[model samples]
Target: MIVKHGSTTFLKVIIFLTGIAVLALCVWLPEIAIRDARVHPDTAFFLIPFLLCAYGFCIAFSVALYQAYKLLTYIEKNNAFSELSLKSLKIIKKCAFTVIFLILLGIVSLRVLAKVTGGDDAAGPISLCLMGILATSIITAIVDALQKPLKNILELKPEND
Candidate 1:
């Protein structure tokens, strides 16, 4: 029980740090993108829309991280199986799916830009977007899987009460 408690605390700290890092990245990415665009004028046309999409996804990711923090709090309070936890998981799943969808859209945009520009520079960001989609899809699936058992527990709890 003590070890479990310690691990939860550690995880919460890690999550907190991760949330901060995500925020920092969200702020930093636009500046970097702008600088790169200035250095490479040819890509500036697509960079504007990419930065906009990136900012939108950043907001979604931040919300998902906040939900994870709330879920962690529920676990620490011995309410991991409660409706609140389930709701958090549901929100997190939606956020992950939103991210996946946004990345897929970005992939299509990059493809179009590459064809129009007749350049291979978009390949790098396209690969990154594909990986992002895959990662977010997995996160969404895991959260969905968690929701099932949590839903069962939440349903049974009232009868037991």
Candidate 2:
């Protein structure tokens, strides 16, 4: 059975956006925060972790998005879910967890640091966006996992043919 490749274009665009977002969050944002650290230590603490997660997210997101691209290509060729896809998905899942962990740790650390240094909002929209992105990736992993059984079933050739 031939697989479809129509959605790959969509995936590419998403991957591009995510990459840009990572750059903005990781490199640019952290630098600004660090530069402003003398004036705002509390801000720097939060920004540091945000940078870490952003870079991490960049690497993880790239891998997953690339794998998705590869998966689409494989589908175009009517290949089953190869080890590549499975490995990629596993990495993606791990990345999501890591992001979540880093995020949680950052929040707790920032909250305490904030109280000591006197800052009201340690975490803003950036944290929320990261959490949302990680959550969505997790859900996607679940749905992607379901594809295994279906692919196996589909791969079974008709005996008569």
Candidate 3:
């Protein structure tokens, strides 16, 4: 009992820290983007579009994080194998897919911008977007894998009861 409670506490702390960092990134990204637009005349044209995509990504991220928080709460309450846990995982998967799609779109746009400008300045952001895609895809896969076991447990629950 003690070990289980301790683990839950640890997971809660991790979730809280992750949520704080993501929220901070949400706030910081736009400030730096606006500053860059002011400093670099060439990038000014892309500022609004970039900001809009960033906002979209942030929204998806926040929703996923909220789902994670709920999932964690369910686990703490010893309901990790319940239908609600599976539902939360499904929502997280959808959010990850949305993030992946958005990042891929951004990558294409960045490539086009680079080609038109005849420079590789967009390379850095393209690389970042690629990394984001990789990370979110992995998260999506893991959440998807988690759902299978939860579903199995849920199936057994009704039979056992």
Per TM-score, the best of the predicted structures is 1
Alpha carbon RMSD to native, model 1:
2.0
RMSD of each: 2.0, 4.1, 2.1
The C-alpha stretches of model 2 lying farther than 4 A from their native spots are 41-50, 122-134, 137-144, 147-161
The residue-by-residue lDDT of candidate 1 on 24-140, one tens digit each, is: 988799789979888979768888788878888888988998899898888877878788999999999989988888888899888888788785678788888888888888888
True lDDT of residue 91, candidate 1:
93
Considering TM-score, which of the candidate structures 1 and 3 is the better prediction for this target? Answer: 1
**Candidate order by decreasing TM-score:** 1, 3, 2
Residue 6 CA error for candidate 2 (Å)?
Answer: 2.7
Of 1 and 2, the candidate ranking higher by TM-score = 1
- 1 against 3, candidate with superior lDDT: 1
Question: How far out, in Å, is residue 137 in model 1?
Answer: 1.6
| Total backbone collisions for each predicted model | 0, 0, 0
Residue 139 displacement (Å), model 1 = 1.4
- Quote the positional error of residue 39 for candidate 3 in Å: 1.7
In the range 1-161, model 3's lDDT, one tens digit per residue, is 12377877787788788878878888898789878888887868877777777778888988898899888888878777778999999999999999988888788778877887786688788888889888998898899889998888888988888
Model 1 has how many clashing residue pairs? Answer: 0
TM-score of each: 0.89, 0.67, 0.86
